[model samples]
Target: MVASSLISTNFLFSSPLFPPRSPIRKLTIVSLHKIPTPSSSHVKPHKRSLLPCRPLCPPCLNKLLLTTRNPFSFALDSLLILCTSLALSLSLLVADVDSASAFVVTPQRKLQTDELATVRLFQENTPSVVYITNLAARQDAFTLDVFEVPQGSGSGFVWDKGGNIVTNYHVIRGASDLRVTLADQSTFDAKVVGFDQDKDVAVLHVDAPKDKLRPIPIGVSADLLVGQKVFAIGNPFGLDHTLTTGVISGLRREISSAATGRPIQDVIQTDAAINPGNSGGPLLDSAGSLIGINTAIYSPSGASSGVGFSIPVDTVNGIVDQLVKFGKVTRPILGIKFAPDQSVEQLGVSGVLVLDAPANGPAGKAGLLPTKRDSYGRLILGDIITSVNGKKVTNGSDLYRILDQCHVGDKVIVEVLRGDQKEKIPVVLEPKADES
Candidate 1:
């Protein structure tokens, strides 16, 4: 009974209201009898606590409360974090797109007036320009097969709707086959119709469709003034339809033909870029009309040197017309041979020295005397022609050039120096005899 009372007292001391002063404080209550164990073997035994039960500290109690949180609140927090990440990613993508759009630039859609005119000129005339290729036949040494090989290239333009094309004669000289490529890149075999070696002009015919042919507008070179703006269109170095522009640097210039040793008179000079492949191309005026034909460039490096020469269209017009009508030029001739220009210049003479005059010829019928060597081996000077129709005859070339302006039936006054007497003679022009 006393032990029971002591246990009840211990329970009361351990209660929440009446706690012990020290956490390690122990209660020593004496028991009168020992507790008996349970008799049933199947009954489980209760486990005794090793540590004394105590109330949790303030920090541990707060941690326990936080661990047992509401599951719904945790789920809401996770959703909020995911939403923030997606919003940041979307904002960054929007910024990148804005930066890219800011860097984009728009192109210009309009051109200046001069720029527009140049563009229009090229577009209008490019269709009329054509590319010419010269091919030569060569036999392969090993295969023993004859094949046409490309020898050179040049440029040309349409002359008429009949498929006639005009280019430099040197471009087609010695070529086994000729090929012409149109502006549309359509290539056709060309046949040589006629060529003037002295004028360096050639006429070719291609059986191309009439619709593909666009003739260049013709212009007169007679009135072309120096410093007038000009344009050149050609296949420069095989590059088709290239255009170069400059002013007319000079007029009435002369250059010798590569085909013939004769001089090509009345040539037009320009600063336009005329290269190798531009030999047969057309030089046009600001109106996009053909004014000249680009034939050569005065360059040592085989490139443009700001000194390019062209055959004036005025000369081309007459020569081409004659070539189309006749297979060759029918130049009026004075049937008398004269000494070389070098010989006359060395002798310090002012007129053409008549070397020979054939019997029954115009010069002979006009009683023009020829130089002779007497039996004493002394030189006898012949009739020296001083002028033709008031035009001074300085040399053989000058005399021939003047006669070229006259027709076969035309009459001209010829002034000659016979010994110490000056005489005027009348002579009728005649066709030149065919050269053997």
Candidate 2:
């Protein structure tokens, strides 16, 4: 504010908040009321000329101004006015600075201990994860020419220093060409090494240098406990290297393979997000070890709905080992076609009904009878398999699961219910055919 407005509000030479440093001389004048002059007597008695609340007449104000005017008091008023103005301006400046500080952006803050660990896990594992592209040849309708087009894409991880990558079988099911892209944006042509459709596991080989391959650390899934923390890294929706974390919600879960429609047992179920492009990605434990491979999700809209499943590393480790040694899984089979479980249940049969058995196969040669029809076209039921090596055979899945633990060329005793009498027959298991 200007010096004049401040001085007009309180004309005193000193203020309570901002007092003047120099001492001032006190001035006193005679009260007009005390004067018994001839002019004062002419004034009204109720209105004193010098009363503080009452206004003074022009003649009285002129007489008071002439008496109070002095060189010393005038200089003191000027100094007080200057000092009060500077103090008021400084107070306003300090308030403006404090108000402006609220708008300033804060600096970066330090990350928490757990947050730093998660960040480091992702960085260390990203090099092992890779992006896979499945391309198929298609003929154009108008141009009548054939060209390769991207069929689908998924994720994979390095398996060894030999450039072998592991992924789901359905990812490259009908693709005519495949490409693997590393984290460094380097792309390489990949060829199928081996695949097991029943387990939904496939291995691909890239001719890139061994230095580019960083195998994922393996962990045992057999000893895993529920509610354990896990991390999932994949290319969700084709976006590379997205990390998700959750706890193991379940164990020993079962899911059907998309390629072969067979039951994959001992699967891991987690709440981590796993979308379409996340197939074949690694599901790691808190220790940054591979415990499972994400395969499918339980969602109606085909997007992540928090419930997802992964093929256990114990099952995948065995299957991949067989695939690498042999061109396919080395699972042993009985070499016979049995009736479906639904059909057997309808027939009130508790065991597998042997519908057909080739005469040249092991089951036929071992005296296992196959169901047939007589000359009159009446159904003639054959022997029904009751057990294998002392283990009960309830359905096809149970039989396959038991056989998965057996080896080829191993002799096993097959118990069958022939008519009303039970008979035990010895049969040597054989390698399962790839086409079957």
Candidate 3:
């Protein structure tokens, strides 16, 4: 009799949601020996009975044993039976391990440290978040005001102890009456204190007590980096204060200013889900500091598309400072109309092409040439502004923005391209009037 080693493979498949299982194999060894025979039984020394047998190779033997029947078949069947049982046992063990490791199991029936930290931060800041609803009224045939109409809903935050709340101007655009609700389920009437449409920022005042006002801490946007963790709390589409998490996707991206038609450079881009009502909410850093004001999102379905834009805190800081101090933003301006410097180059010129200048304006009074119509009704070329106060003017917006940094009554040198000649002229900075 010979001993045989039995082996079997029970390979497992893989799934996309779970890790692949390990290949399993079991080996069974059967001990075989000659049975002891009594001496008296072999007294006659009977001629050795030679059973009809053929030398079978290991592979052939296995096949024959597995396929045949009788005493030998029973032994082979036992080997296979043992192998199957071992395989089943191993499978059960592996399954148990997989089930144990597949999902998280809370031991104390509570959140983990990281999760608790997140919940804590949300709990701490939730009270400071607010939901704002804007309503409008329509007149009836009798010229009497009828029922109020719901215009829109948006998010805001407690801005100061003076009951000043801040929100996006677009949120309350054309709104007659505004209402703000805090996280504690308290509502209050709100009024617009100051608004800068160009910056898409508006300050609202509520009659809430000092204890109810908890201004959010402001952070410096200049210190933010791409991929820095961020959080946003807002009333998305009238849904109460909801918190979304993501990272700063980008910075300094030029986006259309909601308040003004001019492009706002240095805007903050985030991946946080900023929906309709999130328009005026704060985009906060992990430290709970406001880095940006959630303004717009790129979504075709009016939902968050994973791409949202915000007004950087630096821009907000500038606008809010002016708004708080003067009730209006007196943005600096250069009294000149011109196109991009690249237009000059594309048009085969070497300077900023002046488009128009207001009569009695700073440029007109400074003797700066302005584009005019010719006798034949053809548009004649005008003075091309090249620089301001020795600073190169790249485009109309650039020149405009640069001039905005200047105070009214500030004197600066203006360079222009008169026809084909470059010359410098002295001009005084003028206050940009409200064009509304």
Candidate 4:
């Protein structure tokens, strides 16, 4: 190592071992010293550098030592700040994306002309719907005479200017009298003109003035599609003049009426809120035409469960036209009591089973055979009818509905199932008594 040169005693010396100064030189060194007195009350700036260290050292050397000792402190603080800023930025970006996705943005050009027409139709048809109240005469046993009591309330609409109001038969069930209240708060006493219990339909004649009757425009239900927009207007739970909107959830549903054992076929199902009092209300298409009658709701709580059922307008029109003209529903029927259409496994048979046939009925007169017992007294399943009028009968309801298209006296071709063979038989249909 090269020896560092030191200035001492006003002389340049290479090392301590190189030379020793005389006493006179040492006294000169003491006189050249500006070292502070140890007992000094104040520390002076001149004393700071004079004691031990070199005054010629660079300032960068001291800075390098400080950084080397606790290097992570400053770096750690900077890293934390940078990480915090990045987290905040990510959070803001996520929030923006979520807000953008929450809404469905539809352009006006996306809607078809037919959609607009449907919306206009619903707007126009909502007003013609009316609320119906059924008042029954409940006789007190002590009094022994009939008097009026509010039995239930439902919905209905004016059929025509002839003062006829049409509604579901179940609407006025067990009621001795009926009344109709129009949208204008006009109340009128209604008389039961005709009722078809099997179809769950009834018509009431309210002798209101001609102007009080605003008939709803009827619509054909054959063209309804699932997810089509529909509206319901009725007095739900006696809350008068309530309007509910929803999509046609389903179609061609078979619903049974409790008032009648027969099934109401081709039922329309919707998501609109149909409650207790909305039973007879009109379900309107987009053009405000009456497409269905809002009748039953699928709810465990007996309220609007968003799943509601309606009587299709096609069924209502056919029944109501007959009821108003004939004082009864003109429902056609196949003249045989076939087994209830169920799975073959459920019926314990490979074909449709004949449970009963009226002796004087069409099937009886056609020589269609009934089931008989064996010699050992074992029961044998009867001849199963599989079709009527050349239409294949899948079940009992199918047969009934197919027969409903025919008049009472019309002849129909019937198909029957025998042991290992299918046979066709001609039966002359007969008029049957009305089952009310």
> Which candidate wins on lDDT?
2
Model 4, 1-436: lDDT tens digits are 0111111312222222224454222111222334435576685545333213344234434433433446376456545555655565566667767877777575656668967765566456545778888898877899799789898898888889898998888888888878888878888888898998877889999888888787888899999999998988888879867777889999999878868667788999999888788888899877688899887878876656758999999999988998898888655554566565664448655445776777877777887877779999997877887787778766767766777678766778888887768888888766555533
lDDT of 1 at 209: 100
Candidate 2 per-residue C-alpha lDDT over 1-436 given as tens digits, one digit per residue, 9 for 90 to 100: 3444465446443333344574334323344564444466676566543433235645556545644668566567656766776676666667667867877877886999988988989999999999999999999999999999999999999999989899999999999999999988899999999998889999999998888889999899999999998999999888968999999999989888898677899899999988889999999998899999999999877657858999999999998887787768877778898888898899887888998888777798897999999999998888788899999999877787788789988999999988889999999988766533
> TM-score of the candidate numbered 3?
0.70
lDDT of 3 by residue, 1-436 (tens): 0111222232111111222363212222221434344578646644543221234346445534433437565656556666665666677767777877878675675789867767777888888888999999877878686878888999998877888788899999999999999877889998888898777899888999788778888889998899998888998868877889889889888777765676776888888888778899998888888888999887777656768998899889888877777888776555667765666778886556777778667787888877788889997888877688888876666676667568778888988877667888888866665631
Ranking by lDDT: 2, 1, 3, 4
Residue 388, model 1: Cα distance from true site in angstroms:
0.4
- lDDT for 411 (candidate 1): 82
lDDT of each: 0.83, 0.85, 0.76, 0.75
lDDT winner between 1 and 2, please give it: 2
Show model 2 residue runs off by greater than 4 Å. Answer: 1-107, 300-303, 434-436
Ranked candidates, highest TM-score first: 2, 1, 3, 4
Q: How do all models score by TM-score? A: 0.72, 0.74, 0.70, 0.67
Per-residue lDDT of 432 in model 3: 64
Q: Which ten residues in a row have the lowest lDDT in candidate 1?
A: 23-32
Better of 2 and 4 by TM-score: 2
lDDT (Cα, tens digit) per residue for candidate 1, span 1-436? 3444454455444333343464323322222334356799998977743322224445445434434557576556556555655565566667777877889876866999888998999999999999999999999999999999999999999999989899999999999999999999999999988887878999999999999999999999989999999999998878757888889999988788898666788899999888789999999998899998999888876657659999999888887887777856766767888887888889887899998888777788888999999999999988999999999989766785787588876888999999889999999877766720
Q: Name the best candidate (by TM-score).
A: 2
Point out the worst 10-residue segment of candidate 2 by lDDT: 22-31
